[model samples]
Target: MEYSKHNIFSKVKDSDEYFLLNPLSMQADILNSVEAQRYKDKRIENQQEYFKKGYLVDPKAEEKLFKSKYLDFIDERDSDEIQLFFTPWYTCNFDCSYCFQDEYTNPDEKVSDAVMDAFFAYIDTQFADRKKYITIFGGEPFLNTPDRRASIQKIIDGANQRNLDIAAVTNGYQLEEFIDILKGARVREIQVTLDGTHEVHDKRRMLKGGKGSFDKITKGIDLLLKEKIPVNLRMVVDKDNIDNLLNLARFAIEKGWTKSPFFKTALGRNYELHHCQTNNKRLFSRIEMYQEIYDLVKTNPEILEFHKPAFSISKFIFENGELPSPLFDSCSGTKTEWAFDYTGKIYSCTATVGNVGDELGTFYPKVDLKQDLIEEWEERDVLSIPECASCNVKLACGGGCAAVAKSRTGKIQSADCRPIKELLELGIGLYSKHEI
Candidate 1:
């Protein structure tokens, strides 16, 4: 048993390969390859500059701050409840193979009003008199076609009437079509996905007609820009798209997407669905992909200023110091969030909805879905988990994305851990050297 000096984990690595917590194991030679050294050095130097500019924080330090701040804010005895996610529809226009919601019945089917009422009622009670952040996500939220859109509008209106913060994650294909509704609805935040460049994005995401959706999606983004809606363009990286990620980043920078109100990149969610497995033939190990991207950004110093919030969070901790709260290395859903399916069934997050045994509980007469979930989340305190406690980077990585872990392993406790761990280390290394 290798105990980490950080006391974050009891045993850093286990006998099972999947349980191994070696950050180095996930690194790709391409990352440290001699040809990449020049870039890596440049990245370090640039990151230091970012630090001077107050652009980053040290991960460990951030963890300490996060925990303390959160603890001070949360009443230990009051049953701290902070976040929730609601997915109105599971039907999406683009079927990327890895969708975890596939297990749910097609979005075409309407969930009984009884379920919606029960679920919302639960939310109303648990968050009584208190404002909370709410996220709207879906297979393709825009697919509600006719009445669905109106229903979604109603949900938003209802939330707004209660004075809640709102956000949504969408595919963006229907963005242009929904501009009026979105503006009128006053959605606080909107996230749209772009997997890679046109070629890479189209390969993984396509329309029902088998046509690529890149063009249409970008057009929607342009529309958002025209509408001045706060937007975040989400890019998911898989093996097929890893090589081009920096290029994608550069593209985002060129379009001024970085400086724009919305822009972020997430590694591909772990798991292979039918179409999402397009990179199967050329799959790079998770560690390889993570390191390559980290290295790419490290060497190309100019891109650091445009780092997405997720990366910025990592850099913040690395450069400034850790916060007290546990970092959310895992899926955000597991710790502070969850996804509610159309039928009112609740899962840990959007990516793990359809997985077996992943349900925390369903909307039912006794469950009190809202209160139950908040209670369940507190019971499963992420910092106390065995796996997270034993890892040195535990504070930095935040126990890995819960959604990714559940999607790949069918259990919330066991998702692919290599990439996230490596990402934290890379971010820390970059931040430590930053001048600020």
Candidate 2:
């Protein structure tokens, strides 16, 4: 018997106690110095318990277990539920400074009735065996014009006919105009971005003509909450807006937005995707972003009332009170999720949705697929990646984002590894102080 390769051990700050996390089993054990030493020495072992906990393992047996778990994770990808992201247009009203979609040409191409017909036809025939739902994507799905609103209604109507639930990622500029349509449809949740306080948010998320959008967006959020429609408030964080995060949190609390059960919030790292946005210099790395949030939470605990920064490890611990289940894959690309742009071009995931060369195939007019490329993406997971297979924290990291990997290494087969040790250390400290 030997120490498991998957075990991650770290000392709790300013204390003799330590945490032993087994990502495979999603278990965490807090141990004192003496206890940790005893376990390491195999002096107080019930061999069976030690083996079961993955504190000690036989080499061959460990390999078998890893293989079994990896296979199970891959097999579970045969999910019955299918999430489809449909882009009605690519022309958003807000011209946020860090908008990654800006890398693609903002074509004025609209979703015509013919396109919608082809889309539904493709779904019926190709995805017939699966349950389906639709997520209306941008350029601003709710653009506030009568013609745009009518187009949205048509998309909603199509989904409603199939008893499909609908969700949308919009700028929330014209949410008021579509309230009636939203109320009628099987609305799931609407995701709207609010970078920071009015000053910060308006500057970052502004109208195309450089007008402030704070008032309009807040009004739209108010309407959604009043109607009890679920709203996920997203904040795109970067160096420019990092300082204002706390102020935004305070604002949300003051407005009682945080207290609403129908509301949820998340922070998106403003980073490069297919190509670097103009604000690349101001972008934060994954670990850097989490560190910023950690510092903010430390200074002002009230921010936790609005939303907790659950960087991967912290999220698992907070949600499950355990380490994290071993992840065979990190993303849903080419698997349970697929993205369909306004032109009927299909891609693996949202990150690659509007990318120039990433289209997996076309779904409209007739069903066409680049099976080789699709299979390549579909087969990607931690177990399948050379670097990920040998990493100690592969379970926690899950090989990082496929999009990031592709962009950085020019290959989807690599891992976009985070600073796992630092992240885990931070997570341990953060969660130790806060219960959730």
Task: Report lDDT (Cα) of residue 162, candidate 2.
Answer: 88
Candidate 1: list runs displaced more than 4 Å: 1-4, 7-81, 97-107, 111-115, 262-286, 305-314, 318-335, 364-377, 382-384, 387-390, 401-425, 428-436
Residue-wise C-alpha lDDT for candidate 2, range 1-436, written one tens digit per residue: 8888888887764467777887876667788898778876768546687677886778788889888887777666675477899998889888888787886788877888888888888888878888778999988898777778788899899988888999999888888888999998888899999998888888888898999988988999999999999999999888999999889989999988998999999888887776667856898988888888888888888888888876667667866755555777887887888999778799987888888889999977667999999988888888778898678888887887888899989888888887777787777777788777
Clashing pairs in 2: none
Q: What C-alpha lDDT values do all the predictions have?
A: 0.57, 0.83
Candidate 1, 5-33: lDDT as tens digits: 23211111211111112221111111233
Q: What TM-score does structure 1 among the candidates reach?
A: 0.71
Q: Point out the worst 10-residue segment of candidate 1 by lDDT.
A: 9-18
lDDT measured at residue 390 in model 2 versus the true structure, 0 to 100: 74
Candidate 2's TM-score reads 0.95
* Model 1 local distance difference test score: 0.57
After superposition, the stretches of candidate 2 with alpha carbons farther than 4 Å from their true spots are: 13-16, 36-49
lDDT of 2 at 204: 86
